[model samples]
Target: MNNPNALASQSFDLAAQQHPHLLRSASYNYPHRCAFKAVDDGDTQTVNQRLSISPLAIWLNLPARRFDTALGRDFLDSLIAEITLRKEAFGRRPVTQLLLRHPFLHYQGADITELMHLLASNFRLNHRDNSPIEYCAELLLEEAEGANLALLKGLGFNEFLLSLPASPSRGDYEKLHAIWQHAREFAADSLGVRLPYGYPEQDLHSMRALLDQILSLKPDRILLTPASELDRWNLQDHIHEHGSNSASQFALIYNALRHAGYRVLGNDCFVIGRDSLAIAQNQNRLRRTAIAYNSVNAADLLGLGPAASSQLGSRYESNLEAIQPYIENLQLHKLAIDKVLQLGTKAKACRVVADQLLCYHRLDIHYIENRYELALASLAENISWEFNAEANMELMRIHNGLLQLSDDGIMRLLFISDTFLAGLLKTPKKD
Candidate 1:
């Protein structure tokens, strides 16, 4: 059998060469011109000026353009197939049925007409059924409308358009609004109940109310997504500069949720309360925190629209941002996975340590040593002689401080005011 390791090394080099710009862009200190521009633009808009523009108003007038292209679609398909093969080979267990059923996992990009055609062809090829595909297409449409509404609200245009006078612009706003409203209504009627809005509200009271509702559901896991709220608010401001009332409401809501004991899990994802804390703390205490939950645990995260990411195990895949490339790729039966990273044990270990330290402000060295079979003394030995002595001697350092060694010979990182968990997690930059 062909060795995957040999293939991976070759693929890695090929990927690096093919996407030199992206590879180079991975450096942490890369300067961002757009950020500087945004900062510069922030001061120019007055509150009155902000009031005139709805965050989503510009997009309302802008064409409802498709973002993915044929090339991108084909690339994504091929990529998905490749990644799926790799996942089956190396992943710990069979991809769960729950994962396959998840909304995020089952997501295919929004161009319903295109997706329908593709589904129809697949049905024809298999000669099995078309009902599932038909149902999925309808579901996809509903999801698209929901996303559009989210974008509208997030961009601050939802309120702005609502506040607009009856005019051509208002008519345009109504057209887009009607499309999504109808979609939601259709879904409700078909599903036989009101679909729960997964998104949090924009007011503290409303947000708290939403949390109470979520808590009542007694979910096994909760994802905290402060960044999504922030992004929506920020994007709204960017759309017109002054920011919208809806975005302001969103920010207020997000803050309230955070105050109510939601801890961030990953980017734009959070889990609620003591349960999440307990899980994280236990993982930290056990030192298997890193291996337990991570990108690998992300069952199926399907990209719903353009420029979105989907995660299956440790493999993260993305779709093309442009409409043309996405279409062309799909026409060619390809999946647009522009980048792929098959994380190794070392990388996974680093991620775990980083996440624990960052979230809990502590580390269980005993847990790490026991789980990974690496000794703290050995780790200390690897440090330079001077730093090594400091680490070794610090075993008897002051009590109740930020850094401490437990009775079991595990290192405990307390609330060290000056230090951040990121420093410990990061790997040294490769020259």
Candidate 2:
């Protein structure tokens, strides 16, 4: 791909095939490969060597689908086993974040509390801390009762990202408003609202109303996500049509939020401009993820639970997706990994540069060239970037060996980042 415009005009499926690693997401991280493997003592030794590179930040992700079935004793035992493995693998490495996604939808209230305490104890995380773990709960708004929020806060979750239904009812609005007030009273650090757009049923007016209600609460952040549920059945004609018009919707929301003195941070997140994430963005410390921000730069992520992904050094892997196999593996005291992708030296360099661009919207060109031993200047000279201010308002520029993105460039970060990604992924000519 030459530029953002070129990427926009190409066949998405074809581009994805060509650069699956680069095009994983326009804004999120996803593993590019999944290769099944058996877990045993040999695997354990491999894991131990990789994990010895410690002080990696921990992100415990509990995906909701596994809990859809009634919370059984076996599942609890699986949870204990996984936690034990995590603790033993990376001993005393503090968990910086916990993501409990929509657990309230399936489990009973008491069960939720029990699970929280279990995690808290094993993970060495509690409700109160001078250096608190970012415990974010992504719950359906309908399930975000005052009681639920209170329980979460009591269990060490400082952040809340509530998901709104495509077309929420008046009662839903009222409940969300009440929950916002409860969040304030309970001293929650951040309360974010997320709405999944790109469905035919949702109109701009209703979206506006939802944004208005969310803004009235003075939320810390607002996110707009694309709803791709229809894609499963190959009924994406409406989704595609609406997805195009959704750009206008985004322009409307972006303008409205900016007018209201809010900062449009990153692609889809709008912040009120004073919270930790917003501050992190200003200080260039913000690292955006699917659910939240990482304040620190360069921390490895270790994910636990069913289908969780991990990024440790040059290694990227995931737990078994099937709960039965995952639980069974842990029951047998083995690693529940389903796939592993060990990055090549070139791929690692590309990933690091891509991460810097995504995280900070600029690349320290000198730092990268020296560290990776790459001829970036000659490589950059051969590649054409969108640098004309007249055509695209100076989308990207390289001056004095510093590669930077303009505001418009940052808006098209995925494509811009992919340009360098493609270059780095190319096989080097042998001497």
Candidate 3:
């Protein structure tokens, strides 16, 4: 219950006072070491931690035990209300397509639509909502005649997923089947499904079987992700747990997509032919965001909620996660920011280059040069040497300032490690 505003600063002071060099980016605050119960996985801890996410995504995630809590619900209401009241300040939509923690909601005595509407508090989602923009390709395209055309996509104009229950019951699957059977009629502009890993009795056969069931829906795209969003979540292991290498696992998914006549899109996203994303990729115009591929720049993101993040200009900031602190700050009309990292020139330059590698899998050295006067020799003597220590040395190289990743290097940056990326980002020199 300390001032959430200073929590990030205090933690920074503590880390600097102790072990500053072990860290890399000062702006990238590690959540575990922040204001909450870092050591425990209790309800408050998780809620406090997760509530740090944007309100849309937070509601998607139901708390572990408490299905209903007056304070939590009220807090969530306030969060949305505040966002709704202030549009000019943030310049983000209140009715954005919220990421629902699908598998967590209970429907014993609740209407999913009503519950979703209540939670969102800012948008309208009907069975027939028709979005103005296309969403994720993971969904099977809708070709029905005026069926459910009122279900519009929300603020984040991405795919709408029926987050499968973590522990699905007969009823769950039945409900899911009913929805999927007529999902196309939902008038969804674009639809996608997120298939999560880490299920009971996980094996290749089970994976394939579950995948088969999902693919049978013919979603526009199939995005495979980890059920648990842990920082150390091993997606490769989830794909083929039999001690498979990254290359082998990559081939597994790549080949599977080919077998299904589906094209392997960037990251883990797979797309059917003629999908908008595929077209965008074909034209080299697609840009990836947390919500999936879009034309919006990732650097322009402004997050809200406890520990919600915002990356504006050359600075990054995140709110404090504790509910009391967040609510208190909002009541005081102050941004619930606990940490801020103002990026230096080199950091920004490196970020642009790194983001290219991350999102596009290639570096536009010319773009970096036009933006900043970064020298090729400085890049080699300093940046190159620094990265080589952390990244795969064999894949590390800086040829005339046009940094390119080998297939192995791209795989490393894309699939497994951010070690090379971390070294590229400059840490703040403590005063």
Clashing pairs in 2: 127-156, 389-394
Query: By the TM-score metric, which is better: model 1 or model 3?
Result: 3
- Top TM-score hit: 2
Give the C-alpha miss distance for residue 74 in model 3, angstroms: 1.7
| TM-score computed on alpha carbons, candidate 2 | 0.81
RMSD of each: 17.7, 4.9, 11.0
Query: Which 10 consecutive residues of model 1 have the lowest summed lDDT?
Result: 54-63
- Score candidate 2 by lDDT: 0.63
lDDT of 3 at 423: 28
Instruction: Tell me how far the alpha carbon of residue 208 in candidate 1 is from the true structure, in angstroms, after superposition.
Output: 4.7
Every model's TM-score: 0.36, 0.81, 0.60
Question: TM-score of model 1 relative to the true fold?
Answer: 0.36
lDDT of 2 by residue, 1-431 (tens): 13434433232333344433221124552212221232333355446634563334455555544343675767667866787776655655556666677767666778777776666666555346576456788888667878888887777778888888778889888888887777789887778887666567777898788778877887787876655531232323543456455555655666677678776554556777787767877887676443345664425676777777777655676788777898899889877988776766677667667667766667777776787776565445333343343234677677888777765665555545565666554524321
Task: Report the C-alpha lDDT of model 1 over 302-377, residue by residue, as the tens digit.
Answer: 3423344443333334456554565456456555434433334443444444444434434455565455443332
Candidate 3 lDDT over 123-153, as tens digits, reads: 3322234433332212212211123213223
Alpha carbon lDDT at 317, candidate 2 = 67
lDDT of 1 at 189: 12
